[model samples]
Target chain A: MPTKAMFLMIKQMLQRPFTNPFPVKHAPKDVTSLVEKIQKGEVKIHPPVPVPEGFRGKLHYDPERCIGCRLCITVCPANAMEWIPELRKIRHYVSRCMFCALCVDVCPGKKFPGEEKAVKALSMSDEFLIADYDKYSDNLIEEPPEAKEKGI
Target chain B: MAKTTYYIPVGPIHPALKEPIRVEAEVEGEKIVKVDVKRGFAHRGIEYMGMKRNAIQTLYLSERICGICSISHPYAFVIGSEKALGIEAPPRAQYIRTIIAELERIHSHILWLGVIAHEIGFDPLLFWTWKGREKVLDILEAITGNRINYAMYMIGGVRRDLKESHIKALRDMITYYWEFTEHMKEVFLSDPVYKARTRGVAQLSKEMALKLNVVGPTARAAGIRMDVRQDIPYDAYADMDVKAIVPQDIVGEARGDAYDITMVRLYEIEQSLDIIEFCLDNLPEGKILAIPNYVALLNKIKKTEGEAIGAHEAPRGEVIHYLKYDGTRDGPAVWKVIAPSYNNINSWAPLLLGAEVADIPVVVAYIDPCMCCNDRVAVVEDSSGRLLDYSYLHKKAVEKTRKLEKELGVRR
Candidate 1:
């Protein structure tokens, strides 16, 4: 117990703090660069460029290449992916995606592709920031602008 | 029924359990005679997903298992994949991995300290600890692009490379953290209230801790010096000076208990700080990742069929990932994630059985049970035959938000 107390006291006495005098002094090494990066707009918040080669990016869906399988929606942990019945396509809201990449891995078409290159890929992007909440709602379901105009 | 004791089941969904876990506490006149833990609430069938996803995809999926120890999970998984493929990360990549892992340990231990303080009703200590933790998080956000899921670990190696500026940042953090340690020590260790509450509260004997095969700080607290980093010597740990903090010898004396365990953690943070500094100073220069050639790597992975166990000492405890792969794309993995909480959970019975009710939260939090990860075993059921609507309870709690807002003078 005496040793423990001594250890504590020594630790307290000997330890030198590294906290910066915030707003007066420059930020700590990590924070300084972070502030610089943010100021330079280097860290993209919205739809950022995806890192290459097997990087899990934003959910990509090709309406033309659709086999209309709901495997992606069923496996989504965050329930971000939903199948649009009217347009016969799968739509994903970026806000709802947990980036778990369950959909990308589970896509069977990638396993047995017959032509059209199995239209699903996740390109890495840093654009995670959502500027407009309503835009997400707009992209929630797939419907062509012409389809809405024709009312067919 | 021969006069069965009244059972009060406490979770599957309860505020006390961080993730949805249930506890059946059998009590007679305020004395808990028997306690059963139920889990499986937050199990996202991660192993099943691992089986379906390719090796690279599994890296990100494994990270989502728990938000707190996110880095450790993927680190273990990626290392396992690397072993299966017989690929070694470059020297610089290995150093980066070590630095990031230690940074994670610092963040996680600090967070646990805060949570423990909050659970024990020491609000001020909790606030102060979290405030200090932000420094570590700031470092994390800078080093890795994101604050939470770092996405740094890749299959062959890591994705990001450390710049000279990054090294300087780490050095700066070490200095700041050393100073912050004094404040943490004063508030958490020296404070009379904290010591009185935690000192002998959750006493687990060294023999019992060993018998349970407990890993990490819990085992270390009980005088068992076992750290995977020291034992296995993976990545840059093989080159670095890694020391395990044992409670039996702190300044050449034996002091073992909950408080001693807490002290062990505090000291371990200092040790980690030193390791991070050493890694930065001696960081070898090399490629961040092995050159990307999918076909050859895929074929190599397919040809290798064996099992390897990768264990990492996470902030919570020793995390072991046992991987069995038969060379193929999307190979079957019998992944057994033995988190620190698993070993410490049983120890809780001995710790909390005879303690006061106020001591329950503290004792439970001390183990830092990743209940979300461990909720696969037990289920708690309310015996009233009338199920409690947890959402309704949440609604009631949310209703008080307005009053809390008014208290904060939002309307004014």
Candidate 2:
């Protein structure tokens, strides 16, 4: 028994617990009412710990910059991206995405023929908590409308 | 007349065990006479999955084999794949891989410490140890982007690079963690309760450990000087000073008990931190990822035909991946994964044979069995022994808990 450990144990006993009581200061008896109260601004929930830079999370698609190369479709580990030849675009099913971000790395950040700067058509955003009951829910997929005309 | 022996089966489904593994013990009045371990419930056929996919795809599949040792599987797989392809990762890439591997070890050993403490009915130490582990997870999440399944490895090199900020974060973390190790040593070595519960229980002699071929901390606890990192230096361990921490080095003698296992892992956590710091200081500058384009790497693998074995010292023990690539096939012709638990399973019989029923959880946890990695293991019980189901094992485990609770007067 080191004296430091004894002092540290005593300090821990006297101090507050390390875990945060999230959703509210105290746990609510019922979760549904707590949510309702949160929606009504009657309860203030603690924000989650901030994610660091370059965090791989939800898919953020920019169809305007896409060349329709389907490089992302080929490299995605989860087959999360679906090629839409009819629309000359790709649709991402976020639910199936493994969040490995290999597609993001493979997608060419090349500048277009006349463009001055390079832009990535597919990228991952920090907004990760995208859980939903419906797999086909619109919010769960990322299919930004193509900025170019259908026949460009 | 011979004394009548009672047969008791535990798990393949029990509250204490997270994975599906059954241990049948033939007992005589709470004293275990013989023990047999069974597996085969949690098999997802990961090796078969690896054989059906290309090397590029199988790398990610390997990551999914064991959530705890996720980094280790891919690390070994890439090494084997690289050997077959005849391409070596750059100096920088190797150092980055080493950093990630050691960080994985810190998180894993700390996680196991909490689990082993919990099994011994000490929840305070479990909670405190987990608090210490969060710092390691933060460093991991900062570098690899995910805490558990870090998808950080590629065939030629690692997927992510360490920036100056990442290096600073790692340095700060290692400095803080060095202080925490002292606290861990005191708690694990000096706490009378931890000593009383673990110290001479589930002894696996050095000779028995060598005979059974147990690797990693379990073997190290028994004073066997065997560590894959030191035996065959892989990645950046070739550059760093790799030392095997055995129980004899710390506690004067190798008792081959649960306490020694705890000491071995605690010492390992400290060693891992030191390795991480050394890698950061001596990190060579070059491209973090090799084969800038995926298509080129894929095509290269398509033309290569060879078989290679990659062995990595995972936090648990040693994980070996054997891959046979055929030029014309989409994936390897044959893929076999030998996880550490596959080798450590043999020791369970000897450790549990003569132990009391109350100590079943601690003894089983002593091996740190990762059945999820070695999915298709089986038990070899006596042919005449009858089988038992889940409910019977659950009731027995519950009874043990009740006995402890009553003895401690926690329950009315």
Candidate 3:
């Protein structure tokens, strides 16, 4: 039986490793130069595993489709949503968000004028690389267009 | 000359342990003469937080209690909550819930197998096992959108409906695990080295397992056919006949050792695969949620006033959740979770009493102990060997506060 295990291990040695070694397939010296090469399409980068449909990740809040019902605020388990009372829009903190997408589900998503597609106010984007040094960093917060318009 | 003894404290943080749990073993040579397990390190006060939130928030919060048993906890929570609210998930949703729960079980059991292998210094086996485990996790990701905290289960029903592609993926996963479990049984059960390491180690008698109130595979390995699924069926489990897999069925005698547990877990994976297969065969057609409207469901929860206990046979053991809804709040007024590790950890002290130092990791890991929910009150023992009660602790706390106040020259 141990022989079977050994054979399995030996077979594994001959076979390609199952895991997808992301970013780069092998280690590289002068990583910034490698990135430059990658940017110039001089070197091929190993791709990360493809995520499935409905993968919960960094959220995208559509300001145009938002009704500002505050239901997402009420349903968000992490309490990551703060209401901008003047604009009647909610600001979402990505660092605090657990990515359960309960907020996305409770959004009562709608279609805006001249748009055929129904867009949920809150939706999950595939962009998972949204980490930042500060919890309240601009990258982590979803500020509505109204706030941007007022520059407040 | 008489033998000398050494006091070995195995952890608040040890490589053998995954979580913070202190095991004090008085070793007389290699054999342990005494053992004491001190827990309560990882308490999150989640119940208090749950009581403060609305029902929907609390539901997702329940799923966060444990990473591996994410489905199990929410399964129990929703079952209890639905009982309290008199809401029944439709037939299709129930079937889907069963499928997801079984997928989790398959992944969890394989994970434990890998963990036990890693504990025994079998790195290749751990790697091999975990590599196989990726399939189930992928299928889980495809189905629930997330791998670990699958925010799928709702009080009335599930959030997402299983698509045809999802079902196809699950079937492929089931086929993959079938052969994988067969290989596991061959690699683990028949391997002389594995047997040498695990045989007769962490042996729990049926009597001892019952006395300790052990649930899930640990108790089942000890030859006790106690499973919440078999005893008190819930959701789709009620529609199917589920039986507890014990070591006796495979080996003709139950050793109740770490090896036997390995056997039990292996067989349980097969069982889970069968359950998933059955769920797929009998897949019903209908809406996923009983109350499709979230606000309406919360409103129904707000008007509901009742109490119920929900128990799910998790991969580790039975996860029980007691919920009391008092009409005023949308969430349960009182929420208490009983993770299987709470009872499963009880066997460790007894099992370790006469175990060798080499057998320590096996004994510690046999129950697949999760210390997260085992936390309640921490007992402080004085150096003089007196167990300080809460009142005495409170008195000492007050004294310390006053002492700090005096030192700072500040008064309230």
* Candidate 3 DockQ vs. native: 0.74
Q: Quick one: ranking by TM-score, best first?
A: 3, 2, 1
Candidate 3: residue B13 Cα off by (Å): 2.6
Name the docking class for model 3.
medium
Docking class of 1: incorrect
lDDT of model 1 at position B262 = 82
- Model 2 ranges with Cα > 4 A deviation: A1-8, A109-114, A144-152, B1-6, B376-412
Every model's TM-score: 0.72, 0.89, 0.93
Query: Which one wins on TM-score?
Result: 3
- The reply for model 1, stretches above 4 Å from the true place, is A1-96, A99-136, A139-152, B1-8, B27-31, B251-256, B291-299, B375-412
Report the C-alpha lDDT of model 3 over B146-232, residue by residue, as the tens digit: 888989998888999999998888888888888988899999988888989999999999999889999889999999998999999
What is each candidate's DockQ, to 2 decimals?
A: 0.07, 0.37, 0.74
Q: lDDT score, residue B268, model 3? A: 88
* Consecutive 10-residue window with the lowest summed lDDT within model 1 chain A: A45-54
Model 3 stretches with alpha carbons more than 4 Å out: A30-33, A36-42, A115-118, A145-152, B376-412
Tell me how many residue pairs clash in candidate 2: 1
**What does candidate 1's lDDT look like per residue over A46-66, in tens digits?**
333333333344555545545
Better by lDDT, candidate 3 or 2:
3
lDDT per residue for candidate 1 within B1-412, as digits (tens), equals 4545557787777777767666677665556677776556676667776777556556666787776888988888877777766678898999899899999989888988888878877665565677688878777777775667877787677877787777888898899999988667766777776788888878778788878777889888888778888888899899865778987677454345668778888988999998898898888887887734433444565577877777788888877777777766544356656666777788766665656556667777887888655533333346876655767667868889978988898874
- What's the lDDT for residue A53 in model 2? 74
